[model samples]
Target: MTSPYNNKENITDKSSDVVWHNATVTSEQRAEQKKQKPVVLWFTGLSGSGKSTVANAVEAKLMALGKHSYLLDGDNVRHGLNKDLGFSDADRIENIRRIGEVAKLFVDSGSIVLTAFISPFISDRQQVRDLLEHDQFLEVFIDTPLEVCESRDPKGLYKKARSGEIKNFTGISSDYEAPLNPEIHVKTAEFSIEQCAEQIVDALIERKYFSF
Candidate 1:
């Protein structure tokens, strides 16, 4: 399928005669009803960088505060929605492109969507950011050293990648372009998971994304 969004990775030509649909209610109205802003917390990092762990914890914190939120994890999404894709550069671009569209939908529904994806390429992540409003996308870099991520290897994929069993594996065979200036940068190697999560959640509150 072709991407409707203006992106460089459009594999197929845009379809003809597909009209855009306007929602009856505005995004501001939806977010006002939820008492928070519709935002996408895009978490980018290397494998085993604690992206999922930190995102899950932040989601829990949002729940406790009664905020509407959802998390789209990389592995979880690959299990189904993007099952057909691979780790090739082209496929990876397509992966984030599809995710950006999905996250835009969640934002329109007035929910804070947290996405956990290695998303190694800078352009791919920037494409996702372009899909949202100017202030709606917050890039959170889960900064962890290569050695630290490999050592933590929650999944054995890292070990396999090191052994030449897997190709195009981020941080092992593939390159991970770290964020130059992310909205929030958390060094997972230096902080506990709880501390990292709190730092993110607190940043949201301080930015007035949500208030008591």
Candidate 2:
């Protein structure tokens, strides 16, 4: 089997002996049946930046609109699927990589997936984008300032990270490369959760994800 990333030899998972499988029903068929365009809404930001909060709100809105959707929250994922991953840079990259593959699977099944993760690295986020079609992935940047996030610190993570209790925290010990030009940018500091979520839903509706 040819590697998905044939050009990037170092990261390609090759298995010449294994056969590539195709589903009997195609993704387009599934999407048509659901009357929606499946896509991944990737929410990236620093801790306490309302990634999860806004994503949850968006998912709720999608639900109310009768669209099929799923949310993959970072902390919840680490508790199960990514339990073995640590706080190292390599682990962080692997975490996003795995999540990207999972999001692709959801998209294939005609469901909109919202992933809420710090996803601090630009390269890692780009890798996820590469896994999907042109319109299959939309980057949603929750642009909350460091001061605002630190002040909110809903999980007390910032306090711990500041006190040297947590290592490799994004926006602190680790680097958070903000999206240079994300598809959707929402500043939680300036807007309410409903407004931010509605902004995203409006974008998808304008994009014709589903006819209202």
Off by over 4 Å in 1: 1-14
Best model per lDDT:
2
Give lDDT tens digits, candidate 1, residues 1-212. 75445454452344444568898999889999999998999999999999999999999999999999999999999999999899999999989999999999999999999999999999999999998889899999999999999998998989999899999999888999999999999999999999999999999999999998
* Off by more than 4 A, model 2: 1-14
Model 2: per-residue Cα lDDT at residue 33: 88
Residue-by-residue lDDT tens digits, candidate 2, 1-212: 87454345544444544687998999999998889999999999999999999999999999998999999999999999999899999999989999999999999999999999999999999999999999999999999999999999999999999999999999999999999999999999999999999999999999888877
Model 1 clash pairs are: none
Cα error of candidate 2 at position 29, Å: 0.7
lDDT of each: 0.94, 0.95
For candidate 2, give the lDDT.
Answer: 0.95
Error of 1 at 108 (Å): 0.7
What TM-score goes with each of the models? 0.93, 0.93
